[model samples]
Target chain A: MANHTSTQASFENQTTWAGGRSPFNVSYGKLMMWIFLLSDAFTFSTLLVQYGTQRFSNVVTPITTKWPDPASIFNHFPFMHGLHLPLLFVSVMTFILILSSVTMVLAVEAGHRKSKSEVARYMIYTIIGGIAFLSCQAWEWYTFIHEGARLDGNTFGITKQGYDHLHSVGFGDHFEWADGDRTFGPVPFAALFFIVTGFHGFHVFSGVVINVVVYIMTVRGVFERRGHYEMIEKAGLYWHFVDLVWVFVFTFFYLI
Target chain B: MEFYNKPGDYDAINYIPHTESHGTKELWKTFWLLLGITVLDFVIYFVMPASGWRNFIFIFFGLVKAYYIVGAFMHLKHEKINLALVILVPMVFVLGLISGLLYEGSALEVMKSM
Candidate 1:
């Protein structure tokens, strides 16, 4: 322990840090959070990049079959089923996430002011927004599995539905799964959707849980006693990162 | 002050960031800006077919949205240069990865053409 401390001190002395608690004027906790989030960013970027690679690579859209378009898959909205609105519900879900990011920022601001009630309010709103986004994703996933009728399709597609109404109207019989030489995977499209969106949905679930735990702690006066609401700020960082990743996912997976 | 106070301190508030009271106005502004951009993104997608230019604009707006969230909401714009670079520098590698993927993907497309 003594040698470790001396070596750490020697390293600090070798640098211009001067042995202060924070090396970059940022608290140790916040800096560590940023570094962790940076690594997580790389993970997501790699996932999406691989998605792009697999999507464009090895995709031969024969006249008899075309890859599944996102707009056609996500067209169904609640109670307005048959409207053929392209990307409407997905856009709504995106805005819900963005709105949650806003609430999280407000919660961080309130934390800066050391206003407990304000923090609780904003945190609750943010949590609610997170839940709403999760609900939307669940519905989207359900619709995908139900409509595509791929029971053992991918690792993520769990449920199955008999009827696919979109097939009756939009791009009828667009996939020739029997042609092994043409399609990328047995069902590459479904596989990619399940992997990318399922991973993102998992992140949302964790973020919501983190927010709830932090909200409870805020209500319990943990940060108030600790002299700062930095935990809330950290949570806000994670929530915003989730939103940021979703923005890229929407563009790459849905639109482009 | 609560953590560093040497007993009998005058300030009662246990604040961390000695903020200058800018309030949440900027948060609201960024929210509106992001919302407007999102709506515009969808509208652009709706109005325009998925052409080269359309895809470029879609990715451009996505990048802008990412910047807004990181800069405004996460307060990276206000942080130190080292911390900001710590996050941004790794992102360039992501760009590299995407470029490489694009090349490989286009190669596949070319093969399909052939």
Candidate 2:
């Protein structure tokens, strides 16, 4: 008993970050993944900050407002062509992402249990969610481009008359921009929209690919031979990070 | 200490800490919370006119959603304190950067007007 107590005391006295164990108590891959995510967060934050700066710099004046209200521009829903449906489509996109995030976490949880089949199942659900989101973004981009928004230019500069017309229409009302209601707006508006969402869509696309690869690995019993499923956990971290970034993109881009 | 000093035997590459299933109760709870907040965001977007307060609310909700996603989904809540701080502390500076640049942006607006 005395020796056991002494051993316990020495263990308690040992430094937490001794060279043997991970200071973070996580595996090397997971720790590196966290660091990578921190850097990626900075990337996304810088983009958002640039967005905010561009928007605030183009404040509405008595003459012309450069920044267009997202609602006035992104107020279309699939199958509801002319009706004003601000936030509806993006809301669906958000739901899909959140659902996918949940499924990814579920896969991680199953991985912890070494439940191979369940992990694969949740991974499939997550991949489907990602594909769905990508399709939605494609439709949205097509619509925006079809509406004449371009990388080098923006046609969404709402005139005073356009503002008034937009205000007169209620949610779900049939609304279209009348002539003279729009002018060439700030170039960064469309450009940043494409850049930010395009960057995020690319992340989602890669996330889908990663999920597919991990799914294949799981099916091949690689993890079973390795005696762990931490790969799913690592992929889950990336997946959740994507969802986290979307929360902000949804906030700054659409809702605000 | 001497036993630990042999780095070659440590196998850092494969040293995954043991993990266990903590069940899906909390995860599902977090999902509901995120979904409900999103719904609330939608409702408030339509209900409240665009204003500073509305923007503040949206940002606040965004942060809350971010918290749940990172904490529950990423399992940061169960991570070591050092790990959590290392990951989260730098974000405080990000908030500072956002505010500072926003102020600068407004100043630029004034300059453009001038």
Worst 10 residues of 1 chain B by lDDT: B6-15
Most DockQ-accurate candidate: 2
Off by over 4 Å in 2: A1-14, B1-10
Model 1 regions more than 4 Å off: A1-15, A58-62, A149-186, B1-21, B112-114
* Residue A145 displacement (Å), model 1: 0.3
Among residues 3 or more apart in sequence or in different chains, the pairs in candidate 1 whose N, CA or C atoms overlap within 3 Å are none
* lDDT tens digits by residue: candidate 1, A100-192: 999999998988888999999999999999999999999888877876535346322111121133344432223321223222223556777
Can you write out model 1's per-residue Cα lDDT over B1-114, one digit (the tens) per residue?
333332222221321334433588889999999999989988897678667688789888988888889999999999888879978997987878896886698687777779
Best by TM-score: 2
Separate DockQ for every predicted complex:
0.41, 0.50
Worst 10 residues of 1 chain A by lDDT: A155-164
